[model samples]
Target chain A: MDMKRILVYGELEKERLHPVSLELLSKAKEIFPESDVQFGMVLLGSGIDGAVAEAQKSGVDLVYLLDDQRLSVFHPEYFAAALIQAVKAFNPDLLLMGATYGGEELAPALGIRLKTGVAAHCTDLRLTKEGKLAQLVPAFGGKVIGEIFTPNTRPQIASIKPGMFLASPQEDKNASLSILDASLLDSVSQRIRVKGVNRKELSSLPVEKAEVVVCGGYGIGSPENWNSLEQLAGKLGGAVACTRPAIDAGWVGDESSMIGTSGKSIRPKVYIGVGISGATHHICGMKDAGLIVSINSDPNAECFNVSDFKVTGDGNLIVRSLLEALG
Target chain B: MNIIVCVKPVPDPDKYNLLTIDPETKRLVREGIPTVINPSDKNALEEALRLKDLYGAKVSVISMTPLFSVDKIKQCLAMGADEGFVISDRAFGGADTFSTSYTLMKAIEEIGTPDLILAGNESADGATSHVPVQLAEWMSLPHITNVTVTEAFETKLHVRKKTEEGSVDYEIDLPAVLAVERNSNQPRMVTAKGMVAARSKSIRVFAKDDLDVDESLIGLCGSPTQPGELIVPNLKRASQELKGEPEEIAAQIITLIKKSGVAVAV
Candidate 1:
């Protein structure tokens, strides 16, 4: 049997390989376990020596490095062009990237340029009987998981959600690297120019990266009441999060920290929801957390349905008491 | 400028609890659930209408859904879309975003390439956010997603796109596709006069034969991805309804927390 080649697009943040890239590398091994399958990586960005070193330890067969100053900050058109060039060079049978802001933009752009099929936010992937890739994803707001395929399209593509797979690095004994000259990608213009970037600083750890997250909702009542939740989170050694309504009401810092379809999706070790009436939008984001415990006054609050532990009581009082008890 | 906005009718998220998965067919049981214009698609249409108001552009709306979605399309018309089209056909059922983009791209081609094409960042149901870029690629036009702010000029468009770390502003030439992010603009409400005008405004239905699309690339049969085993997560949780005063409840919660291995001192 011929080798079934796979390409993993390693995302870079300030010259370091994003952890999701390693997770995708781990996932590629699980999806294609056959001995004939070869894994390749396309790492794009300037000053990527650290990333290149990490890729060496990833056990991939080949590394296509496209490093340039113009590629420092992600420009969708430029990044997509670089990726398409690598695709043509390696001609991999499968392509995977993290379903992140950059990956979401680049993957579809390639689908149009390559005229291939792409499955976005795939939760699972497998090789079919006919040697095609099968993608499994949540649909209708995570109400159902739909199996997807791109049978006729060459180089079937998928963007896996970050945190869906665990990252386990295995160093390769025989690994080779090839640096693709960025100047060759002159055909792709930087059509969309980035004038400025105003970064949102998270005073605490990002909710997605936190091991334990204590989330508040309208039940928390006011921005002043958030102090108690924050204290509770502090006592638990976790970060503080909130629902869309809390963000809308100015009880939370920003939408980036909100838990919902419009905000960041989190899969922490423990998720404690306070005063939240679980909307589907919010549920979809935190449903995958390891353990969910909810406290709400209203017994009928939807948050109780998906929660592993439930408490029927006033949110503020309970939070204050918990803080007092922790002391 | 002529602008086209894509809208999809989705089950009202308020009733998502009533949603069920068909054990055998592996599809959403959406029979009794009323359909509403997807929330973000409304934002897309609202953006288009704002452009029409400021620059006097013509805004048209399109959707690929069952014939039943005609009513939802009319809702778009009632919200000030100049025209509406429903690309409905039995053959188009169960299409992933790729095939859906193919069919929508064909519709856009048939309708003529407007100066700008707009879509919601993603559908509430699919939440893929792929159509805008995929369709733009099919048309070979420039595109952007997660756009929170937009300013249209005579020859170009300026947009602010949202990222995980921050927001970046971009300037792109006209004749591009854009996926409008949620909360970009508040969708206007349906008015009495707009609803009355919708009575005479017709929603054109297009089938597979209506456009220059290859037969194998229009529906589930042409779709490269196929659905496999269905897995509905068991979301049921253990129950312990805390009774009594706030102090007692807080003690119980602390006990539960400590039991979960969190090193909370009591």
Candidate 2:
């Protein structure tokens, strides 16, 4: 039996191997245990020697380094050409990437080039009994899990969502690294240039870092009533957070303020959700909070199921009452 | 200027429902759900149309899906795409992003390189936002993601790329790839004439052999990633009760805050 080789795309950043790369390696190990699972990584950009050293520590058999001044910034065309050339040279059975902004765009484009089934936002992966790739992805806005398989294809490709799998633990510092020169076609007119890269600062007082979090939902109504949540958060020596609806209503910024799938994922010590109906998207963001407290009007709200403490009442009235009681 | 907008048909996010994995079959029970164009891709189409209207460029829509997606191609034509192409094959099933990009790159090569290749920032189904970037890589063309604004110049293009904190402006040469943000522009409606023209337009379909692509490098055989398992996180809520009149309730809230030892300045 021929050994299945797996390739994980993306550069290994200094001090951190891209999470999805580790996840792919982890899944690859599980799927092709008996097969010769040679993990390959593609690193682009200058000053990636540190990254190359880190990739060596991640248990990859070979690292394809495409170090060029033109590859410093993520120019799609150039990177894709390099990747295609690399894949053709070192053919692998599967290609996995992180479902980040860059990964989403890169994955489908690769799918088109390869004329293969490219499953995006895959949350789960496994090998079928018939020895084919089985990818489980969310079918409808995370409402359904669709199991997709490629029985008759050679290299199955997928992009894994962040936080879907655990990044592999640091291995022994002595893993061997083989560096291969990834020949990239040079370009004359690179379309997009990164004039400047600005990183968004996470909230100064992130709810995730807070020992206590006081969150509000749409039931609080009007931005004016937000004062109550602030007061509660202030009293608790914590920060305030809001559901996606509240954030979308322009009541809060993306940082420290919003807690949901699209926003920050938090696990505070004490999380109090006010008037939150406990949608899955919202709950997944903070379900791991140490002590959960929910105050809502609906008796059968899903929030009750996960809360350590439950209060059935209108959010506004209860918040004000709590404020008065605190005083 | 000629443009090719790559669009994909995905299952409607709103209509998605969880299926009970028959522990035995472990397959989704998708019996009665409708699919639609990915929301972001719709925005991409709208942006394409806007560019055409602004500069009178010819726009072609391209996609790769199962044979069932022919209706989606027709819809794209109705929406004002000058032409359409579908790359569908049984062998192409269950490919990852790498293979998908390879297939799309082949189509782009066949369609003849255009001045601009427009795509949505992300698909609702995948929402990874990597396809356009990958397409750019395959074509060896400059590309921009999270595009909010696009202005075509005589010999170059100017665009604003949306970042997490703010937007940055860039001026790139022609023949670039751009992934537009979903909220960048409202897609225009299909005109009556466009509907008629679309009906007359032919959709070009290609198989694995149509493009000079290695079958091993095009599909599952060439993909590197696979989804392992999917467990939908369940949502649970708790309830609280505050018994009192309006003013009394407000006062009670204050008391509760005080009792919790949280500060509340009245």
- lDDT for each of the candidates? 0.83, 0.70
CA error at residue A290 for candidate 2, angstroms: 3.3
Clashes of 1: 7
Tens digits of lDDT, candidate 1, A1-327: 233898999987668888889888898887677778888999999888999988877888988999897687777888888898899988988889998888998987887778777888887776678765668877776666667777667788898877767787665654689888777767775567777776777456878788789999988997778988998888888889988788767777567678865466788888989999998778878988877889898999888989888888778888887877788
TM-score, B chain alone, candidates in order? 0.95, 0.89
Best by TM-score: 1
Instruction: Report residue B255 deviation for candidate 1 (angstroms).
Output: 3.7
Tell me how much of the true interface, by contacts, candidate 1 captures.
Answer: 0.67
Q: Candidate 2, residues A185-277: lDDT per residue as tens digits?
A: 544345555554445664567565576788998888877788878887877678898986786566775533567544455666678788888
Docking class of 1: medium
Per-residue lDDT of B1-266 in model 1, one digit per residue for the tens? 99999999988866766778787877668779889888889999999999999889888999999987789999899989999989988889877777888899999889999999999998887788998888888787888898888998888899888877788888988898899987788899999999998888877889988888888777877776666766665666764576767788778767766676767666
Q: What is the TM-score of each predicted model, taking all chains together?
A: 0.94, 0.69
The two-chain DockQ for each candidate, comma-separated, is: 0.61, 0.27
